[model samples]
Target chain A: MENPCIICVAITGSLPTKANNPAVPVTVAEQVESTQEAFEAGATICHAHVRNDDETPSADPEKFARLKEGLEEHCPGMVIQFSTGGRSGAGKARGGMLSLAPDMASLSVGSNNFPTRVYENPPELVDWLASEMLEYGVKPEVEAFDLSHILKAADMHKKGQIKDTPYVQFVMGVKNAMPVDREVFDFYIKTVKRLFGEDAAWCAAGIGAQQVVLNEWAISSGGHART
Target chain B: MENPCIICVAITGSLPTKANNPAVPVTVAEQVESTQEAFEAGATICHAHVRNDDETPSADPEKFARLKEGLEEHCPGMVIQFSTGGRSGAGKARGGMLSLAPDMASLSVGSNNFPTRVYENPPELVDWLASEMLEYGVKPEVEAFDLSHILKAADMHKKGQIKDTPYVQFVMGVKNAMPVDREVFDFYIKTVKRLFGEDAAWCAAGIGAQQVVLNEWAISSGGHART
Candidate 1:
C-alpha cells in the first residue's frame, strides 16, 4: 500500500500585501498565475482569499467567482479552497462565496485569540457557514485553531451540519493563540485520530516563520501540509 | 504532608436568574448571605457576579464595591473573586471591579465560542484586564475555557503581566465550548503541570450537570474544585 501526499499552497492570505512582501500576489490574475505555478510544482490544493483594489481584504463574491474561474482554467484538477476566515469579513459576508461550490472551504468551528484580536466565529455564524457548505456541496476543511475546534467539528459532524468526514487542519503559532509546541502538535494529531479515526485525513499549517517547521512535521508524520 | 482542598463557590453567576432557579441570588444582600452559607460549608472562595434589578448582568464598580463590602463583612477570610466574564460586560468594563482590590478576579486569557455567541476576549482587552489585576494587587484565577488559555496564562506570567504564578481553572461542559471529556481533562492537567510546575494548584468546573464529574476528577487528582 502507498500513501500519497497533498501539498496545499495559499497564494494570497487575508493579511499581507505588496508592502509586507513584494512577491505577495494581490489581484485575481496574479493569484491565478502564482497558484498555477505552485500547482505545477506538486501543489495539489490552492487555498485563497481575495483582496480589494486598494490591497485590503474583501469578501466580495464577484472576486471569488473570478478567481475560481481563473484557477479552474489555469490549474485544472487542483483543489480550490475558499477561506471563510474572519479577517476578510464579518457576519454572513464571510460565507458569501460558499455558493461558488469550491472543492473545499475553510470552516472555523470555534473562536480563539489572534495576534491582536479575537478571531470571532460565533456559534450561529459557524452553523450558517456549515449549512452553506452543505447547500453548495462544498467539502469543509475544518480549521482547528485550538483543541476544542476539533471537538466542535466532531459535534457538528454528528449533528449533520458538516457533510462527509471532516478534513481537519491544525493551525498553530499565532500570537495569543496556540503557539508552536511539539507536545501540543502531537496531542492535536492524537486527538484528531481519536475522534475522527486512525486513518482520518488530517493536515497542519504553521503561521509565518514557523510554516517550514510544521511542514516538516506533517510530512514526516504521514499527514498533509499546508503552506 | 496535608494537601488542603479549596472549594470555590460561585454565589451568583452571570447567567441563571430567579426564573431558572428560585434560589438563585440576584441582589447583593442575597449574594452575601448565600456566600456566607457556602463559606461556612467548607467553600473558602466566593466567586461572584453582580446583577441589575431586571436580572441582567452588570459590570458596575459600585455594585462590585457593595458586594465586596458585604462579602468582607459577612464571609471574612474567605476569598472574594469577581467575574470578568464576557456575559457580565464588554471591553474594559469587564475589569472595572479590579479597582475594588478583591482577593482574586477571574481572567480569560483567550477567546472561545460560547453557547450562542463568541466569548470575545480580544488581545488588547485581555492584556488590559491582566494589567488592572496586577495594578490592584488582585490575584487572577485564569479561566482555561480552552487549552491555549492555560499556555497564555504562562506567557503572561513570564512577561510580568501576571504578577504571580497563575492559578488556572479548567472550565468544561459549556455548550459550543470544551465539553466534559476525560482524555481532554487529563491532558489539561498535564499541560498545566508541564507549563507551570508539578505542584502548581489547579481547579476544574463543569457547567450544569457535569459539575459533579469534574469535581470528582479534581478532588481525586489532588486538585481543587469550583462549584
Candidate 2:
C-alpha cells in the first residue's frame, strides 16, 4: 500500500491576528483543542505555537511542556512539532522551545525581510541551533524562506548538524521571500532537488490564499502536503 | 556594470475583475497607457491581456494590434508580450494577440485544472505554438505551472522546438499551479538550473501580493525580475 501523505496542521502560528481568523488557539486548553481538531481532520502532525493566556505569542518552556502534555493526553499518536522562531530579531529567544525538547523544532535557515518585520537569524546562531537540535535528538525542520535559506540548510547537513536526510519546509508568500507564483515554485523546488537530491523529504507552506495552491502543488510534485 | 534586471509588468491581466482593482486596464487604449506607466516605473517588458470595450476578456487580434500600435507609438523600446491563454478550455480561440505577433508570446508548458477551469495544451499544439513563435521572430516564454511543466519545456528544447538557452518564466501561486512559497521556490529554481544549466534566462511571476516577494527573490538569485 502507498504511504499516506503526512498532513501537518500548524495550530497556532506567530503572526495571524484574531481579526484574521477567530479559530486560532491562544491558551493551553485552546492549543490542545486545536491539535485534537487537526488530528481529527486527518493531520498526522500537529505544529504547536504556545501563546500566553492573553493571546500573545510565547516561547516559554512551561507553556510548551503544558501544550506537549495536553496534546499527548488528547491525541496520543500525533507527531508534535514546536516553533523555535522567536520574535523578529530575537535570535536568543529561540532557547525557550529548545529547552522543552520536543520531537521536532523549527530552524529558520536564513534571514529575510518578513511581512512588516525583518527576520535576521545570524549564521552563528543558526549553527548553534543546528547543533542543539542534533544533540537533543530533536528533528530540525529547515524553514527556508528563500533559495539561500535552502543552501544554508544544505550547509548544515554537510557539516553534520542535521541528519543526512533532513526535513525541509518551504515557506513562501511572505514579503522578501519567494513570491507566490509558479515560476518561483519551480525555481525553489528545482533548487532543493539539485542541492539535496531526492533523498530529502520536503513540504510546502504558503501564507493566505497561497496556502491551498502550495498544498496542491506539493501533492502534484510528489512531496508531502502539510495542512 | 551589473546586468540590468528585466521587469515585465502585466499591464492588463485577463483574470482580475474591475471590482478587485479598479486600476486594471480593460480597453486597448487603457492597456497602452498602463504599459507606458509600467515602463516609466522601470519595467522594460510588458505582459498584456486584451479586453473588450465592454470590459470583458478578449483575445481579439485587432485589440492586440491597436494596443501594439499604441505601445510602439508611445514606448518604442519596450518589449511587448502577449498572452496565449485563451479563456477556460477554449484553447483554439486564438485572436488579436496571436495575430499581431509581438516580440514574445507566453507558451504554457503543461495543462492542469485551474480554479473552476481546465488548461490543457497538447504536445502537437505545443510543437505548433513553438514553431509559430520561432517563425514569427517572437521568443517563447515557456510558462511552467509545475515541475513537470519544466521537464516539458526541457523536452521541447531537446526536440529543437524551443531555442537553446530558452527563456522561461515560472508562474506560481495559481490555484492549479505550484505554490508561491520558499520550498517550491527552491525546488523550481534548482530544477530549472539543473535542466537548462547556466544558459537559460528565467524569471518568476507570483499572483497577487506574492508578486513583490518573488520579484525580490529573483533579483537576488541572479535572474531578471519580470512581473
Candidate 3:
C-alpha cells in the first residue's frame, strides 16, 4: 500500500473574520465545533488560532487552555496544532500557548514579507520557540515561507534545537512571499528529500485562492495536503 | 570572448568599524580613496554605505553627495551604487540619498533574518524605495537574500516598478538567512535565467569568509561577482 496522506485543516487563520466569512469560528466553543466537523470529514489534524470576543486574534493562554480542553473532548484522537503565527501576537507571547502541550504547533524558522508587513521572526525568537516546543514535548510543523526556511529547519534540527525530524510545510502564494511556481515547488520537495531522508514526510499550504491549486499539487505529488 | 564580468567592490558595508578592522574606511574622504584603489585594481563598480563620525552606519544624504562627487572625480566611469540596506536606516530614510542619483542603488525586494535581528523591508517601504529609485532615474541592483526575493524582483519588473531588467545579486552566508550551499547557488542562477532571459546579467555576493568561494563560483559560472 502507498503511504497514507494526513489532511491538516486550518479551521480559522488569524486574518479571516466574520466580515470576510460569517462561518469563520470566533469563540472557543465555535472553534471546537468547527474543528470537530473538519475531523469528522477526514482531517486528522486541526490547526487553530484563537480569537477574542470582538474577533481580534489573541495570544491568551486562558483561551488556548479552554480550546485545548474542548478539542480533546470533542475531536478525540485528532492531532491538535496551535498556530504560533505572527498575526496573533508578538515576541514570546506567540508561544505562550506552547505550555498547553498540544500535539503540534506551527513554527516559522525564518522571516519573510507578508501582504503589507514584514513577518518579524528574529533568530533568537525562532530558537526560543523551538526550545519551548522541546520543553513541552510539542512537535513543530516547520512553516517554510521561503526556500531558506527549509534549510534553516534542517540546520536547527542538526544542532539539537529540533529534537525530532522536522515536518516541513511549504507555504506558497502569499502576496510578497513565495508565489505559486511549479519549478520552485518541485525544488522545495527535492530540497526536503535531500535534507531529510527520502521517506521524510512533508506538506504544502497555499493562501486564499491558491489553496485548491496547492491541495491538488500536494496530493498528486505524493505529499500531504493542508487547507 | 565571453561577456566581461563586472567586479563590484563593497568598500565599506554597514558594519565593520575600526575595532574590527583598522583599515575600514569611515569618512567620505577615506571611502573615496579606498574605492579609487579598488577601481584601479579592476573593480568596475563601487557599492558603498556611509558612516557617522563615530563609525556607526549613517543615512546622511550630504555625505553621500560628497562621496559621489569624489568617486566621479577620482574613478571616472566606475559605476557608483549606494546601498539602501536596512542596517544604515529605517523605512524611507534608507532611500534619502536617491536624489543624488548614482549610477545604481542596491534595493532589497523582500525581508529576511540577519545575524541577530529581523532585517525589515515592509511592502510599502519596498515600493516607496523602488519608486524613489525610479523617480531619480537610478537603476536598481536587486539584492536577493533569499529565493522569494528574486521572484519578487521579477514581479516588480512586470508591474513596471523597476523600469529596466533587474540586475540581481545573490547574497549568501548570513547567519539566519541563506547559507553558502552549492546546490542552492546553482538553483539561484537557474531561476534567474528562467525568470529573466538566458542572457540576463546576474551576480553573487558572499559574506565574510564565503566571499572568495562565491567569487570563484560566480566567475566559473559566467555570472558577475562582488566582494
lDDT of 1 by residue, A109-220 (tens): 9999888888898899898999999999999999988999999999998989987888999999999899988999999989988988899999999999999999999999
- Which residue ranges in model 2 land beyond 4 Å of their true spot? B1-227
Interface Cα RMSD in Å, per prediction: 0.6, 17.8, 0.5
Candidate 1: the clashing residue pairs are none
Error of 2 at B213 (Å): 29
Cα lDDT of model 3 by residue, B27-121, tens digit: 99999999999999999999999999999999999999999999999999999999999889998899999999899999999999998999999
Prediction 3 global C-alpha lDDT: 0.94
Q: Which of candidates 2 and 3 reaches a greater TM-score?
A: 3
Residue B148, model 1, lDDT: 88
TM-score of chain B of 3: 0.98
Give the Å error, residue A196, model 1. Answer: 0.8
| Candidate 1 deviant stretches above 4 angstroms | none
lDDT tens string, model 2, A51-128?
776667787878888899998899989888888885622656675567667888888765544444335565567777
Model 3 scores a TM of 0.98
In what order do the candidates fall by lDDT, top score first? 3, 1, 2
For DockQ, the strongest prediction is: 3
Model 3 complex DockQ against the native: 0.94
lDDT of each: 0.92, 0.73, 0.94
Q: Quote the positional error of residue B15 for candidate 3 in Å.
A: 0.9
